[model samples]
Target: MANIRPYKISISESQIQDLKTRLSLSKFPDELDNAGWDMGAPLADIKRLTRHWESSYSWKTAEAELNSLPHFITDIQCDGFQPLAIHFVHIRSKVQNAIPLLWIHGWPGHFWEGVKIMKPLTEGDGVEHPAFDLVVPSLPNFAFSEGTKERGFALAQYAETLNKLMLKLGYNEYVTQGGDWGTHISRALAHLYPQTCKATHLSMDAANPPSFLANPVLTLQHMLTPYSKREREGQSRTEWFTKEGRGYNLEQSTKPQTLGYALVDSPVACLSWIYEKLHDWTDNYPWTDDEVCTWVSIYWFSVAGPAASTRIYYETHHTTRTPENPRAVPRDMLRAYSPGVKLGYSHFPMDLVVLPSTWVRTLGNVVFERDHEDGGHFAAWERPGELVKDLRDMFGKKGGAFGCVKGANGYSQ
Candidate 1:
C-alpha cells in the first residue's frame, strides 16, 4: 500500500461565485399565503436558508476540517474502464494495533457521516480503535470521487471498487457499516469478497424474504400497528409522502435529468432538496438552523448535489439486475426510534431495497437486527456520539454481531 498521501479539497472560488450568481438570479414563483411545498421548496424556508448559505456559511472552515482529517483518492480497475478514483478519509488509530473499519454512506449524503468519527473513535486522544482504522469514502459521482468513465458502473461494481480499496490498503480482513444504498453496497462487498469483509453492520434491514406463500416473516404487530409512533398520527400524510416521495425516487432512477433544472440551477433548491430529506429522516426534532446548513454547505460549496444523487440512482438502477442473482449480500437493520419514512409506509418501509443471494437460504444468520432509542436514517450526523458507541459495541460483542460501537462505556472490551 502506498504511504497515505496528503490531499487538499478542490472547491474553486469561481464555482462558489457561480453558485451565488445562480442563487441571486433565482426567479421564485409567486406563492399565496399557506401555499405549501406541493410545488417544491417552500418560499419562506428557501429564502431564509439561501440568505444564510450566501452570506454566513464558510466553505473554508468545512474544507479545512475535512483536509485536517486524512484524505486520499485512488483508482480501482474493474467493469468500469478507467481505474475508478475513489475519495476517502483514512483516520489512523492514535494507538498502534487499531482495527480497520470501512464505512459507506447512502445517497444525498457523503462521507461526512463517517469522516468526522475518528476523533470519537480514538476517544479524543486518537488512542482508541487501536484495533481499528477507519476508511470513509464518497461514492462515485457523489463527492470528490469521479463517477465511472466506462459503461458498467453498477452497485455491484461499486462493491468491487470497495474490494480493491481494501486490498490496496493491505487489509485482508475488516468490518463494515452503512445505511440506505450503503447498506446494499456493503452487502455486495461482503458477498463479492467475504474473505476480506469479515462482518458488516447496517442501519437498514428486515428478516429475510417470505418463508411461505401464506406466512411471511413480518409480525402481526408490525403489520397491524404503524411502523413508528409518529406515523400513526395521520394516514393522509402517509399517502401524500407516498405519492410525492415516489415521484422523486422514480425520476432519480428513471429520469434524473427531468428534475435537474431546479436542483442544478439554484443553490437554494439544491439545499432544500437534501436538507428536507435529512430533516424528515431525523423526525425534524427542532435542529439548529446551522445544524441544517453544514450538510447543505458540503453540497453547495462542492457544487455536487443534483449529480451526486442522480449518479447513485443511475448506478443502482443499471446494476447487475437479474433473476439469477437478485441481491449480493445480507443487510443488518438499525432502526431509528422515529424516522419520517416509517411514518409513510404500507408493507415496505424504505424506497430502494435489494435482497441478498443467501436471502432465502440463510435467513437467521444473515440479517442482523436492532432498534435504538434515538436517531433515524441520518444516524451518523444526527447522533454521531450514539452512532459511534453503538457501532463499537455491536462489532465488539458479535460472537456474530454485525455492527458495534461503544461510547463512554468503551467498545474495546
Candidate 2:
C-alpha cells in the first residue's frame, strides 16, 4: 500500500526563467493575408500570447491558487508496470454518506478541469441535490503524475491504475464523470471492474450505428424513428469532425514521435497546438490570455515531457492488433455496451463526436440523458453548473442510479 501525502505546486525560479527565455526566442511562421483559424492558429494570436507569456504571466500566482486545493500524491502499481507516483485532488464532503466519484481527464487537459465543480459537488444543498466525495486524478503521463517507461500502457492500464487508487482510498464502489478520452477510460473501468465502478456519466458520445445481429431491438428502434432536429444537426457536426478536424488523431495515433519534437522544443508549438482545439472544440467560450497560458503551462512543466501524453493514442490504437490478446478492449468494444453499470449521457452541440440518443444507448444501461443547445468538448470547464446538475440528477433520490453506492445517498439524516 502506498502512502498518500499532501502535495503542493511549486515550480522552481529557474524553470520560470527558462520558460520566459523560450518564449523570447520563439520563431513564428508567416500566414497568408486574412487567414484566421482556417490556416491553423493565427500568427497574430500566437505572437500576442507569446508576448504575454514572456512578460506578464505570473506562474507563482497560478501556483498559489492551485495549491489552495486539496492535492495529494500516492503510488499506484498496475500489473506488469512499475509503481507509478499518481497525483490527484481528493475532496471529501461533510456529508458522511456522500457518493464517491472518480473524475478522470483526457489529453490537453489536467485535473484543473474539475476545479470549478469541486466545491458545489461536495457541498450540495442538503434537501434537493446530492453531495459527493470527488477524486480527480492527473492521469499518469499527463500532469504531475509520473509517466510509464515501458510500452503497452494503453486503456486497460489506465483503468487499472484508477481502480486501484479508488480501492486504496477505501472507495469499494463508486461512480464516474468524464469527457474526451475520459469517456473511453470511464467505460473501460466499468467493463474491467463492473463491481467497483457502479455507474458513469459522460459528455462525449462515440458509438456505432446499431446492428441488426447484435442489437435487434435497438436496430428496430433506429429504423422506425426519424432523426430529430437536434440529431440531424449533430450529424452535420460529426461529418465536419471526420473530414476537417481529425488530422491530429491520425498524427498522434501513427507518428506522435515525429510531432513530439515540436511540442517539446517550442512553447509556442505547444500553445498553438492546444489553443486551436480550445477554440474549435468549445461552443464559443471566451478565453483570457492568462487562462490559455496557465492551461499550456501545465504541459510545459508536466512531470513527464509533453511528448509522453500523446503515446496513449498509439498504444490504444494498437491495443488488440495482435492475435494473442484477443480479449483486450479494442476500438469496437469501447463503443459497445457493457452491462451491469448504469450510465448517464450529456450531449453538447459543438463536441467533436456528437451521436444521437439511440446510438448512445448502445453503449450501456443508460438511465439519464440530456441535450444542451450550447457547450462543447470541455463540458466541465465550459458548463460546470450543467455538468454538476446532470450528476446530481443521475444520483439523486429519484435518479436511475440512486443508492448504487451503499450509504452514499448524498443526503443528511
Candidate 3:
C-alpha cells in the first residue's frame, strides 16, 4: 500500500527567476485593425497580462496561498501502468458520517478550482444542509501530480487511478462532481465501479439524443416535446463552438506533439492559448490580470509540463475496439446510461456543450437537474456558491441521492 503524505507548493527561487526571464523576453504579434475576439485573444489584453505577469505578479504569494490548502500525495498503481505519485487536496467534514465526494478537474484546470467550494462543502449548515468530506485530486499530468510515460493511458486509466486513490483513502463509497474532461472521467468511474461511485453531479452536459433502438420511450419524448427557449439558444451556442471554437480541439487531438513545442518553449504562446479559452468560454467573467497569470502559472509549472496534458485528447480520440473482443467499458459507453448509479446535472447557460433536458436524460438514471440563468464552462470558479448549493441539495435529507453512501447522510443528530 502506498503511504499518504502531506504536501506543499514550494517552487524554487531560481525557477521563479527563470519564469520572469522568459516573460521579459516575450515577443507578441501584430493584430489587425479592430480585431477583437472574432479573431482570438486580443493583442492589447495579452500585452497587459504579459506586462503584469512579468513585473507585478508575485508567484511567491500565490504559492503561499496554495500551500495553505490541505494537500497530500500518494502513489496509485493502475493495473498495467507503473505506480505514479498523485497530489490531491483532502478536507474532511466534522459532521458525523459526512458524505465522501470526489471533485475531478479537466484540461487547463487543476485541483485549485475546488478551493472556493472546499469550505462550504465540508462545513455545511449543521441543521438542514448536507456536508461532504471532499477529495480533490490533481489529475495525473495537469498539476502537481506525476504523469505517465507509456501511451494509451486514456480515460479508463485515469478513472482507475482516481478510483484506487479514493479506495486508498478509505472511502469505500463516494459521490462525484465534475466538468470538462472531468465529466467523462467521473462517468467512467460510475460505469466501471457502480458499487463504489453511488452518484454523480456534472456541470457540463455531454450526451447524445436518445435513440429509438436503445431508448424508444426517451426518443419518443424527445421527438414530441418542443425545444425550450433555452434549448434552442443552447443549440446556437453549440453550433458556434463547432464552427468557431473547436480549433484547439483539432490541434490537441490530432497533433499535440507539434503544438507541445510552442507551449513548452514560449510562456506567451501558452498564455494566449489558454487565455483565449478563459475569455471565450466564460460568460464575460471579469478576470483580473493576477487571476489569468495564476491560472497559466499552474500549467507553466505543471509536473509533467503542459504538453503532457493534451495527449489525453489524442488517446481518447484514437481509442478503438474490435467486434470480437470489446473493451470492458468502452469510451462511447460512458455517454449512455449506467443502471445503478444515481445521476444529477447542473446546466450552465454558456457552457461549451449545452444540450436539452431530453438529451441529458439519456446519460443515466438522472434524479436531479437544474438550469441556471447564467454561468459558463468553469462553474465552480465562476459560481461556487451556486454549485455547492446544488451538491448540498442533491445529497441532503430529501434529495434523490440522500444516504446513497451508507452512514454518510451529512447531518447532525
Task: List residue ranges in candidate 1 displaced over 4 A.
Answer: 36-40, 124-131, 206-209, 213-244, 301-305, 320-368, 397-399, 402-413
Worst 10 residues of 1 by lDDT: 338-347
Q: Which has the better TM-score: candidate 1, or candidate 2? A: 2
- lDDT of all predictions: 0.58, 0.90, 0.89
Ten-residue region with minimum lDDT total, candidate 3: 321-330
Give Cα distance to truth, residue 117, candidate 1, Å.
Answer: 3.1
What root-mean-square deviation over C-alphas does model 2 reach? Answer: 1.4
Per-residue lDDT tens digits of candidate 2, residues 1-413?
45999988889999999989999999999889889786688999999999999999999999899999999999999887899999999999988778999998998889998899999999976569888999999999998999999998999899999999999999999999999889999989888999999999999988888888888899998999998766889888899989989888999999989999999989999999999999989889999999999999999899988988999999899888357654367777788789999999989888998887888898889999988888989999999999999999899988898888887776734
Query: Which residue pairs collide in model 2, if any?
Result: none
In candidate 1 the C-alpha lDDT for residue 362 amounts to 31
Against the true structure, what is each candidate's TM-score?
0.77, 0.97, 0.97
Candidate 1 C-alpha lDDT tens digits along 235-267: 344455566655666678777666777676677
Q: Determine which window of 10 residues in candidate 2 has minimal summed lDDT.
A: 321-330
Clashing pairs in 3: none
